[model samples]
Target: MAGDAEGFTDFATSCSGRLFRTAWLLTGDWHLAEDLVQETLGKVYRAWTKRSRPDDPAAYARTTLVRTFVSHRRRRGSAERPTDSVPDTPGGETDVALRVTLLGALGRLDAKDRAVLVLRYWEDRSVEETAAELGLSAGAVRSRSFRALDRLRAVLGTDADDPTRSGVAR
Candidate 1:
């Protein structure tokens, strides 16, 4: 129906930016993040057309995006390979450097660990909500979140001596 299409379009327009941010965090590449958002929107659109509308379209889209990222990582023969040197960028700000460092550390984490951290910390979702999103138990989500933070801290080399040094705010 025309009304349904308009509704879906409006929803997509409003949520695309947030979805792209989550996708970018999940995938450390801009192009890949765009593709991921497109794929997620396609999935959501299909579901929207075929079934009754979901109670929470935003949450549905977020779950789909995260699941899609994890599923892609599970697949074999991914074409992406890390390059020895990054392409030159103009910014030299300290905040930019710290953000890049944090993203690099996140990229090094396992997909599930990255998902847990992004959902729990970056998105500021509760443990129960994260558990529901990631299809993990509450205890598992808590455990993974704790361990992932430790791994991230190790990667970022942020010790107790200088908590303020890490760009992440309390």
Candidate 2:
């Protein structure tokens, strides 16, 4: 029991940063992202305590995080605070304007659409894998992925002349 608890702690410590980043992308608010990560960790801990460990714990945790974000979005008060501009992080590798624009566009999407985009593009998941995680058919996942990309492109003001300018891959 002690060893299991220790292992879970180590797992959480190692994975928390990545989980928090995903949550931030999903929620588009730092505070809500923190809360979401904590909630996900708690859920994972409980599942760890109750059942045998999953073969791929990272995948299981990511599924839990996505499901939790979708569930949170369903609540009446799930609307996020709006920000006019992203704060400049000194020496950050990513472009702040692009990141903010992308996140703002993602925040506008419905929960399922956002989930599909995050799971498919951000997480680099396969269509079948994303479908299995979201409980959707493969065809549904593919369709949703295309629609989500279109919506994002519309929000980001993309066009044939500069489709790749948004930094979204084809």
Candidate 3:
């Protein structure tokens, strides 16, 4: 029991930042991202205390986080509430603008599409890995990734042939 607690403590400390980043990308809200991470960590801890620990705790945590985000979106009352004003985020002008624009466009995506894009592009996961994590087939991952990119382009109003125009590098 003591060993499990110590191991989980170390694991959570090391991976929390990465988990928070993925959560933020998935949810596009700072507070919600924090809550998602907390919930994910709780689930991971519960699993850690079980008789059989996951072969890859980090991957398990990441999968748990993504699944939690997707399921939360499916809940009826989990819809986003609009704020009258945007909170200020500190960053350089161009970087901040591009980040905000991209996040906005991503936020407009369906939950599964957003999950596909984030896992495939932002996290740089392979199609097979993403499919496994999302419980989707490789073909479904590929199809969703392609269509999600198109949807992102449409939302950003950028030419499909010139993704750089949206300030995203290839």
Clash pairs, candidate 1, are none
lDDT of all predictions: 0.80, 0.79, 0.83
Angstrom error of the Cα, residue 120, model 3: value is 0.9
> Cα RMSDs of all predictions?
3.2, 2.6, 2.8
User: Given candidate 3, what's the lDDT at residue 12?
Assistant: 100
Those runs of model 1 whose alpha carbons end farther than 4 Å from true positions after fitting are 1-3, 76-94, 158-166
Q: How many backbone clashes does every candidate have?
A: 0, 0, 0
- Please identify model 3 stretches exceeding 4 Å from their true place: 1-3, 78-94, 159-169
lDDT of 1 by residue, 81-121 (tens): 53323333356655665566677787888899999988877
RMSD of 2: 2.6
Query: What is the clash tally of candidate 2?
Result: 0
Off by over 4 Å in 2: 1-3, 78-90, 158-166
- What are the models' TM-scores? 0.84, 0.86, 0.87
- The best candidate in terms of TM-score: 3
Q: lDDT score, residue 67, model 1?
A: 94
